[model samples]
Target: MNEDRLQFWSLYATRFAEGFGFITLVTLLPSYINTLDPTGTTILGMTISAGLIVGFYTSGFTLAQTVAIVPLAWAGDRFDKRTVLLAVLAIGIGVYALFPLVDSSASLIAVRALQGVAVTGAGLMTLSLVGEIAAGSTRANHIGKANAASYAASIIGSISAGSLFELFGFGPIFAVIVCLMFVAWLGVFRYLKPDETRIHGFPFSDLALNRRLLTLSSFRFQYAFSVTLVRTWIPIFAGVAAAEGGLAYGGLAVALTVVAEKFTNMCCQPFTGRLSDSYGRAMFVFAGGAAYGFVALLVPFAPTIGAALALPTEIVLVVPSALAGIVLPAWIPLEVIPTQVSMFGEVSPAFLPLVALSGLLGIADSFREPASMALFADEGTDDGGVASSFGIRELVWRPGSVIAPLLGGWLMYEVSMASVFYVGGLFALTGVGTFLVILVWSHGRRALVEW
Candidate 1:
């Protein structure tokens, strides 16, 4: 391979490692909550609720990500992005290795916080490098491919994590992640070239003030809350107890629920990105965000949908003897060949509909993500601060990413679970409305098609 192709693939490997680690944790979160069983606690004589503690499980990670963004993004712009990426990957290896040590909620939060820093650094450097290397016209196409790599990793990670955790528990899962990170580190070290580009002073100030960026931020800011709340809750709704308003699925089943979205998003991004390259990116953003809100609103109605459609309550598969022997020799006895597997343990009528809705959510977001990313790359590349531009993008997402989990937890525990989806859907709808008015007012009607 040529040096450029090598570098691109290496960076895509980095994205894969990052996505694998992140999705593993996401896939296992319900298991963690079940294991930890968090309760009310007194801190400095003030009581904190269990619901808030549950919220902290996710918020702690995102809060750390919020904290790490400015410094990491600035370092990527001001110094060597390649070096920064390698360091982050090193940290990621350590973080994944530490997952097996999580004994309590507090410990998990601490580890997740460190993971946030690693994830932020990896994401910022890889994306900035991709944006900088690709030409403006094809930036979205390249970015779409990069993101597709991440989603592919997400699919594999969620499925493998769920399956492995079911078979061997958490230790082996992290061991696999650690080994993957090491391989990713080797790819970057051997194939990726050093980034010599440097920018002096802060570019965030300039990029933040860019009118186009500001308009995009208006939509992104609210959309962040919508995406974070809905995405994080999907696995939770699948795996948590039925009494908690979930379907109470097994690990593999829950993983499938999460995979539905990742799989569809992975499939659609590259094509949608190319279309956005030909058509208008802003139009894609508006359409995708609106579709996402509509699909999110339908999530809570999965049971009704399933019942009306007469969907099966459970799915059963009988494994062939040869396949069963190859797949489960270590976990199951050879005498148990031709095993019958219950994919969903006492699955609710909502399972199939929920998975379908999740896939629709992915289809919706695929249009929005690459298009929005291309816009940021366009602005940042013009301003000579691609990393800082993406930083501003991350910063715009911070408040929503940090706060939505807490809000979702409160809504999930205090109100109905459906209320969480309701509130999240409203945010997306309102956000698109605000984005449209601003886009038309600031850039005129033709802006959606032309820009």
Candidate 2:
């Protein structure tokens, strides 16, 4: 392979590893909650509720990500991006290796925070490098392909993590992740060249003031809350106990729900990105965000939809005779690994509907993501601060991503599970409204098409 192809693929491999680790945690989160059973804790003379502790599970990660962005982004721009990418990948290996040692909610939170830093740094560097290397005309197309690689990892990681966690618990799962991280690190070391681009001073200072970027941030800032809450909660909703306002499905079932979105997004992104390149990006952003909100609002109605459609409550899968022994030890009675496995523990009318909704969420985000990313790449490339631009993008998302989990947890425990989706959906709808108004007011009505 030529240098360019090798470099791109290496970067994509890094993205894959990052996504794999992130999604593994997400898919296994409900299991962690069940195992750890977080309760109220007294810290500094103040009592924190279990709900808040649950919120901290995710928020801790995003909080670290938020803190890491500025320094990482600046490092990528001011120094060698390839070095930055490699450093993070190394950190990732250690982070995944630590997961098997987590014995309490506090340990999980601390480990997740470290994971946040690694993931954020890897993401900023890879994206910034991709945007810098690709041609302006095909920037979104390339970015789409890169994101598709991540989503593809998410699909595999979620399914494998869920299945392995069910069969063998957490040890094998992190082992796989650590190995993947090592492979990605090797790919980068062997094939990817050092980044030569360097920009002096803070590009964020300039990009922050850019009119077009500000307009895009108007939408992204709010959309962050919507995506973060809905995406994180989909698996949580499927796997948590029914008493927790969930469907109480088994591991494989939960994986399927998470996979649905990743699969659809992976399939659609390249095509949607190409289309966004031809059609106006702004239009795609607006339409996609609106559609996502609409789908999110329907998540709470999954059970009703499934009941009305007369969907099957449980799906029974018969293990093939050849694989039965391999799947589980032969000495362990057939009762445990019975010929037929119940995918859903009990009657779960909401399973299919939730999966379908998650898929729709993927399709909607496919359009919005590539278009939004391409816009940021455009401004960053034009201004010679691609890394910082993406950094700003992350920073804009930080507030919502950091806080939405806490809100979702509170709603799940206090108000209702449905309330999380309601609030998340409203944020998207209102976000688009603000984005459109800003787009038209700042750039004029014709700018949406022309830009």
Candidate 3:
């Protein structure tokens, strides 16, 4: 490969590894909850609830990412991004290998926090490098491709983690993840060129005050809550038991729910990026966010839709019986029901509609992500702190991401599982509304199309 192609692909590999490792952990969370703490445990002599355990465990990852964003982004800009990225990959190898050794919830959270740092460092550096290398005209297209690689890895990771965990337990799955990270580390060390671009002093002070970034942050801050809640809970809702307001589907079925959004997002990003490049980016961002909220509202109603639509209750297959040419064996239903049915063998009416809604979520995000990313890249390049620009973006997202899971967990445990999606959808709608108001007030309504 040529220098540019090699650079992009190497960065892509880093992005892929980051997504793969992260999603694998997310996919196995329910299993961890079941195995590690079926009921809640006490921490520091205070009784912690099951809901709180889930919240802390999930947020631990985000919290570490939140804390690491500034330092990692600064390093990427001030030093060599390639070197920083390699260091993160090395951290990732150690973190994933530690998963099998997690004996308690506290230990798991500690390890997940380390995993968070690795993910954030790798993500910030790779995105910075990709944005710097690509031309302004096609920046979104390149970013879209990078994001597509992440989403593709998400789909693969979610499915494979669930399958491997079900078959061989967490040890083999994490061992495989460790191998993937090691391979990514080797690829970066061998192929990615040293990044000579450097910025002295703190770049965030200047970039954080930029008008464009402020406007984008207005949307991103709220949008983070929406995406975090919706994306994280979809798998939780599918995998957990019915008494806990979940579908209680098998690992594979739960993975499919997670895959639905990612698969569509992966497929649609490149095209959407090119479109955003040609047309106005802000429009796509607003439209996508609004569409996502609307879809999220519908997610809670999936079971109702399935039941109302009267989809198949039990799938039947024909076999050649000894006495007949073709016969349906009673035993066939027994085999299919356990793996396919939800909630004590009454075929889950919600599966198809939930998957469909998840797919819609993906389609909605596809419209927003690339356009939003390109806008950041544009301001970053113009301001001469591309890494810091992306850093601020990640920084802005941290609050919402860190808090949303805690809120979602509380809502799931206290109210209902469906309440999480309701609040998530509301956040998206409100975010889009706020963004539009800010855009028109500051830039005029014409800015919607012209921006």
Candidate 4:
């Protein structure tokens, strides 16, 4: 392979491992909640609820990422992004290795915070590097491919984590994760060249004030709330008990819910990125954001729609097994089909519609993500601090990613689970509206069509 191909593949491998490790944890979250926080944990003087604990656990990682972004991104720009990425990969290996030691909610949260830092660093550096190497016209397509790599990993991670945890336990699952990260580290050390460009000091203050960035931030800030809530809670809703405002699907079924979105997003992004390159990126962004919000709003009604449509009840198939002479009978409840054929269980009526909605979420994001990323890269390259520019993007996302989960958990525990999706959908709608008005007001009406 040539240098450019080697570079992209190395970065892609790193992204895959990052996604693999991250999604492994997400796939295992329901199990963690069931095992570690059956009664909830008391911090300071107050007794926290189970749902609130889930929020805190999930948010802990993002909080650490929020803290680590500035320093990591700054170091990447000022020194070598390749070095930063390597260090982050090493940290990820350590973090996953420690997952086996977690015995309580507190320990799990602590390890997750460390994992968050590793993830943020790897994500920031990889994205910055990809943007740097890609041609201006093809930047979005490259980013889309990179993101598709991550989503593909998410699909594998989700399915494998559930299956492995079911067959063995957390220890073996994380051991595999550690191995993956180590391999990613070795790949980076072997193939990715050191970044030579160096910017002197902090570039965030100026980048933060850039008019285009500011315009983008107006939408991103709100969109963050939408995505953080919807993405995190979808699996939660699928796996938790129906009594707890969930569908009570098995491990593999829950994995499917998570994978559905990722699968569609992975499949669509490359094509979408090329289209965004040809068309106006801003148009794709606005349309995608609006569509995402609309779909999210419909998420709460999935069960209702499924019931009204009166979908089929069950499916059965006979398939060959690993053993040469063995054949297996697989039965799947139509309402909630297990992704794995070995599991026998009935899920709620809402599963298929929810899965459909998840796919729509993927499609909507596929439209927004690459275009949005390319726009950021365009500005970052212009400013000569690509890492810092991406850092600001991460920073802008932090407030929402950090806070939305806590709020979603509270709503799930205190109110209805559907309410979380409703509110998440609202953020997307309002965010797009905010972006549209600002674009017309500041950049002229034709800017929406021509920018």
What is the Cα root-mean-square deviation between model 1 and the actual structure? 2.8
Write the residue-wise lDDT of candidate 1 on 60-92 in tens digits.
Answer: 999999999999999999999999999999999
lDDT values, one for every candidate: 0.92, 0.93, 0.88, 0.89
Worst 10 residues of 1 by lDDT: 336-345
lDDT (10s digit) by residue, model 4, range 385-404 = 99999998999999999999
**Higher-scoring candidate on lDDT, 1 or 4:** 1
Report the Cα lDDT for residue 396, model 3.
Answer: 89
Give the count of colliding residue pairs in each prediction: 0, 0, 0, 0
TM-score against native, each model: 0.96, 0.95, 0.93, 0.94
Q: What shift in Å separates residue 387 of candidate 2 from its native position after superposition?
A: 0.5
Count of backbone collisions within predicted model 3: 0
- TM-score-wise, the better of 1 and 2 is 1
**Model 4: how far residue 296 lies from native, Å:** 1.0
User: In TM-score terms, which candidate is top?
Assistant: 1
Ranking of candidates on TM-score, top first = 1, 2, 4, 3
